[model samples]
Target: MVRTAVVNRVQDLWVSLAGVGTGFPTGGVRVVVAPESRLCPPCWAGIVVLGDSGIATAPDAATAGFLRESLTGRPLRSAVEAERWSGERGVVDVLGPASLAYLDESEFRPATSDAGIARLPTGHPALARLVADVSEDDVGESGIDEITSAVFVVRDGAGVAAAAGYRRWPRSVAHLCVLTSARLRGRGLARAVASAAVADALRSQLLPQWRARPEPSRRLARQLGFRELGDQVSIRIAAHQVDSNGDRGQPGGRRP
Candidate 1:
């Protein structure tokens, strides 16, 4: 279980992202017009339900009003739910509904030995080769290329069998990411490299965050002693449904 302090730290991070300092009501949702909010993805809007406190962002006050109207009664499970009540302006290109988790050092189950794990600089040639070895979808899911921290890896004769690292997000969050070769997955390469990465993040005094949509990834995070905190989803809403050129309009294709 995550400690109370650790829990609050995560809460504070979301609150900051939402740009709601003291206005975030207790046990209630705060709908704000913050197009520039770090919380807002490239989509029209996004909402994060963190325990009793929740925040929703919109591009303008009118849009904020719509979000407030739908999100008034209680916290939503995800932005997908927001689509149901959006009327004609339906959501498109929904990003997540992913699980957000955090780690506490006291409960961290670091690997017993780091014998095979090696530390490498960001954007190393071996890392590039490993990225090339994996499927495009796998690389996108892992977000391995965005890593700004030291990468931990387990190597095989071909190249890096598995690699793990973190992207430094806002509020000192070390967003953990792990990727493994399809052929070498059955081995414990992911666990070993990820453990090394998590250890490094904790040592740097950054909060380790794990966001996963896949059960296996969630299981790996749980195995490493990360606590499931909340769910986050981003939805792009349709603006006018079509453009002046009489062309089809995708909701998430262009910012509404």
Candidate 2:
């Protein structure tokens, strides 16, 4: 089980992302309009379910009212059950049921570094080659290019075999992003690089969060001493629903 402190910190992060300025719920789900919310795309509605505490958000008043009226008082899981609640054009795409885990400094188990593993800039040539080596879909899933922190990588020949980093998100959330080339799968490189990145985040006093949709990625996070506290899901409002209002991957990962 995760510590109470861990869950509270994660819940607090989502509360900030929800942009509602309301206290985290004690039970059931709460809905609010947070057009400025970063939990999901600018215009799209989203949800973050933490145990029994759930927060759902929409970009504007009308859609927000629809969701607030339809979803509040429902089970916390309803936050992710867009098909049942979003009646307009229905759900567009659901991001998860992704594992949301966080690292505690005391529990962190750093991976052993290899001679070839080193820190790299996000724009390094090896990273570019690694991106080209992987499928476009996988590249997008990994979010390799979007990280705001220094990248850790293991090299194969001259190109990267695996890489890891995190986005410095709001509330000091270090949202981890990791990728391992298919050819280098099962080589422990993902763990090596992810370990370095997580350690760096910890040294900076950032809360390192690993959100993984893929079981392999989830396992890697667990191996690194990140306790699974809850789960995450982001929802997209359908077109017709958006007409009334205005608004806004599993990246390839190897087993730890």
RMSD of each: 4.8, 6.7
Each model's lDDT: 0.76, 0.75
Candidate 2 local lDDT, 1-256, one digit each (tens): 3337767778878888777686567776677777777677656676777776777777766666656655755666766654554443446666666677899899999986556778888788878778888898788777889998999998878888899999998778899999989888897888999998999999999999998777898899999999877766666655444333443211111111
Candidate 1's C-alpha runs over 4 A off are 1-3, 20-24, 78-89, 241-256
RMSD (Cα, Å) of candidate 2?
Answer: 6.7
Q: Cα lDDT for residue 60, model 2?
A: 68
Indicate the worst ten consecutive residues by lDDT in candidate 2: 247-256
State the lDDT of candidate 1 residue by residue for 152-176, as single tens digits: 9998775799999999987788999
- The TM-scores of all predictions, comma-separated, are 0.85, 0.84
> Model 1 clash pairs?
none
